[model samples]
Target: MDMKKYRSTMKRILGCISRYQWGVAASLACAFVTVILTLYVPILTGRAIDCIAGAGAVDFPRMWKILKQIGIITAITAASQWLMSHINHWVTYRVVKDIRTQAFNKLEILPLKYIDSHSHGDMINRIIADIDQFSDGLLMGFTQLFTGVLTILGTLVFMFSMNPAITIVVVLVTPVSLFAAGFIARRTYRMFKMQSQTRGELTSLVEEMLGNQKVVKAFRHEADAQEQFENINEELRIWSLKATFFSSITNPATRFVNSLVYASVGIAGAIASINGLLSVGQLASFLSYANQYTKPFNEISGVVTELQNALASAARVFELIDAKPQVPEDPDAAVLNNARGEVSLEHVYFSYNPEVPLIEDMNLKVLPGQRIAIVGPTGCGKSTVINLLMRFYDVTCGSIQVDGTDVRHMTRQSLRTNYGMVLQETWLKSGTIRENIAYGNPEASEEEIILAAKEAHAHGFIRRMPQGYDTVISEDGGNLSQGQKQLLCIARVMLCLPPMLILDEATSSIDTRTEIKIQKAFSKMMEGRTSFIVAHRLSTIREADVILVMRDGHIIEQGTHESLIFQNGFYAQLYNSQFAV
Candidate 1:
């Protein structure tokens, strides 16, 4: 990520802090107090040492006073530190949860193009693994940063009071430690960033391969898959090692600078004590403060290391959050309630990529209650027709209108709710059979659900399940046969009973016998509704009220099936090829 994006990512973290300021403020305040109390202990300990080592015989009374002060400070330090930790944990997790929720909500509004371009595993990694790293590192990182800084500053005040000359050595040497940390940080951040991206690639590979594991096994591509995975994993290992190798350099580098500072302070203090410029007690206390002062550098350097990883992961997560959503919704959008199902495309032009111009200068109109079957070769804009009509991707130029109002005028919810769809690929969440059937109409009663299932011919097999409609379906409905899943999807659409319907190869997975049975059901259900069927099976759509033949981006022929066959154009060629086989 560039500096602009990094700053944007940090602003997001600052936003989290702002949102939960009360909790963070409490944590910061506790951290501040804890460091102050901790600094007091070292000063008190040195006082006791000077009292015993000087002329008096033990100075028992004075020693008791010093010990009591140290004990009180220690107790407060422990309590305050505990409070700071608890608050930090609460704020960290809440921020993480908020971030994940926002990302998911963004997905719902993002353009299909964005989702299509990104890998599923990469998206998942941002939500889960990257967010986890950010939370762990960011929470502790800020806490330590606050304490380390306050500890250094407080110790500096005392050091200067005891000996200004020695304070100069301490102050000057500290920057060497910081400079080393900064140099190492700059190098390690790039390494960690690359490692984070590699981890996402590995995750994407695993998700892709595992999802298609059956295909892999059937083709016996296990060795090739393994080889591919090993390559990605090896790349990840190299980046991870390089990141670790660079981050590891900071601790020793900071410690070494701090060691020099410690030795110089010790020598200067002893010489000052001999010259009577500093008392034994003051010299002891200054040395203690000097040691405490430099300790935070080592601690800060360690925190910085973890922080680099956090920042890298955070940038990835924020990338998703910051991504622009699909085209903005119209401000004064109208609603298409009680839809008449009259849809039209006027002077339409569209392309997945504008330069390619997959569709151009198209116009079409459909009356209510028409069963329109759109047929074409693969990639001939058959499915694209459904996509545009459903407003998944808006037309590049011109407008799509429903009920005489441009689709852009209607709220997508209002426009889409009027139509029901079942696509070539079936999707089912992990839920009960009944829930899957009732997906489009969650309020559908048991009788209504069963009636829809019977219409789609899924009721028979559903009854054979050990738990009937109550049986739970696994993810993607993997537990059921493809035909079973298709039937369930059809049943879902039937339950919705929208004014318009889209069946994009909806029955492709069913056996011919079952398909015929369901066709009969669909024929009856198509009454008084606009239905667009993108069918590959020529025989199945022969009864369509109108057959629209498409090639490239244009409809090459349009008429009833018999008329199209008589015309002997593209539709005739397609129909003859299928029937002759």
Candidate 2:
């Protein structure tokens, strides 16, 4: 384990907890009171024992006084412990909540590349599972650790006052416990980290399989998927057991050391009492202090093991919270408003990977209210163009301009707000149809939502639902047909009616009949608006004002559909091939 990284992670964890300064102070005060009073009670009990062992009749009044004091101390200690427990819980959970919130907020501003590269399930595990583990470890630390250390110190002080020799014996044996616990903890930290990572991988694998069970079943790859899952599961099991084994060793090792300390303290106290160096009361107090002193070692050793795991888990959470966010917008960036939809790509170049070019020196210009169609084969940068235009990914070189202003100069939110997009993949949250339709324009009225749905030819099916527009769609529109889900997504964009529109196979899932109806609706929607259509079907874009045929990241043909067909080039061959088959 890198001690420096662990130390850094610990300091950050402390910083998060320190936000609740009042709670920390309160818990500290309670712990101090509880441990002091708890240690003091043993002295009181020893005094009561001395009263009973007196040569004459037992000093009943003195015994009664000591017992009363012990009772009061016990009550106060219990009350302080209760308050401390509540405060610790409050502080620990608040820290957890704060960290979880920061992780989620980081996700929002993170670049698309990060989201595309990382596993969603692993991210979810970090936010949920790892944080919960951190919470458990932190809560244990707050509840046991502070008091344990204080109790140890308090016992040493009391034992020293009673008899220095016995106190020395107890102190001399402590390093053994510390050494044993530290040795095991150092090795366990790495194992726990691997355990957490493997658990995340397992979560990602399970999530992948569950999310695509249909594909697995269709492909008849159940046996293969099962074998893959078992491999990950077996790896997770190994890491978990190894981590658990090493951590478990810490407790027993510390306990054995603690037992030796207790035995030495008992032997030394007996000798001291026999030699007239201590009274019976003092010797009894010494034994009690020894037990109290050594008890914390066992507790702290367990805490140390947990802290190792907590630190490991915290490192992962911190990694996410500290992840580099998307490039910051200019402090004085212009906000695009009421855009006229004149978009231009001036020598724009982009690639998902720097090593392999995807779109190079791509140039295009669209007049306001013109329909531009982009047709290309797979992996030909069609959607990449849309992504660059939407600012989902920035260009590697040159610039894209909207309304004669470079898009990079505009705030992403304002730029995105002005353009409505509907892709082939439909997304619907679990909500009423009306709510999903109004997601883009949340303030839209019921009539407006219905109008957009009707325009997208989705109103008929929606109205037939048990509750019409109020019918709650299941997760991802599981209750609805794929075409219906696509229609809802289309209605969503239609409701926004942005100044600029991008329809990338927007009607792919709909049947041919609904496709034609939706096409008519789209035609009305696109009128007087700048639209970019990315279509694989040649039949869809024959009337486009400008057709840009792209191949290998370059636009090789650009003209009206008739002109491109007349050229008998790549575009003509592509258009004729669809008809030929």
On TM-score, the leading prediction is 2
* lDDT at position 378, candidate 2: 91
**Can you write out model 2's per-residue Cα lDDT over 1-581, one digit (the tens) per residue?**
99899889999998998789999999999999999999998889888888887688699999999999999999999999999999999999999999999999999999999999999999999999999999999999999999999998888888887777777878788999888988888899999999999999989988988878889999999999999889989999999999989888877888788789878988887888789887788778877888888888889888888988889999999999999998899998899998898999999989999999899988898999999999979999999999999999999999999999888898999999999999988899999998999999999998899899999999899989999999998888988999999999999999999899999999888899989899899899999899999999988888789999999999999999999999999999998888894
Q: Report lDDT per candidate.
A: 0.89, 0.91
Q: Once superposed on the true structure, which residue ranges of model 1 sit more than 4 Å away at CA? A: 279-281
**Model 2 root mean square deviation, Cα atoms:** 1.1
Clashing pairs in 1: 334-409
Q: Report the error of model 1 at residue 324, Å.
A: 2.0
Model 2 vs. true fold: TM:
0.98
Count steric clashes of candidate 1.
1
Worst 10 residues of 2 by lDDT: 161-170
Model 1 agreement with the true structure over 1-581: per-residue lDDT tens digits: 36776687788788976889999889889988998888777678878887788664789898998899888888999999999988888888898899889888889998898998899999999889998888878776767888899899988887887678999988988889989998988788788889999999999999999899999999999999999999999999999999899888988998899889889888998999899887777777887787788888888888888888888998988889889898887888898897998988899999998678788888889998899999999999999989999999989999999999999888999889999999989999999999999987889999999999999899999999999999998999999999999999999998988999999999999998999899998987888999999999989899898888888998888999999999988889998998784
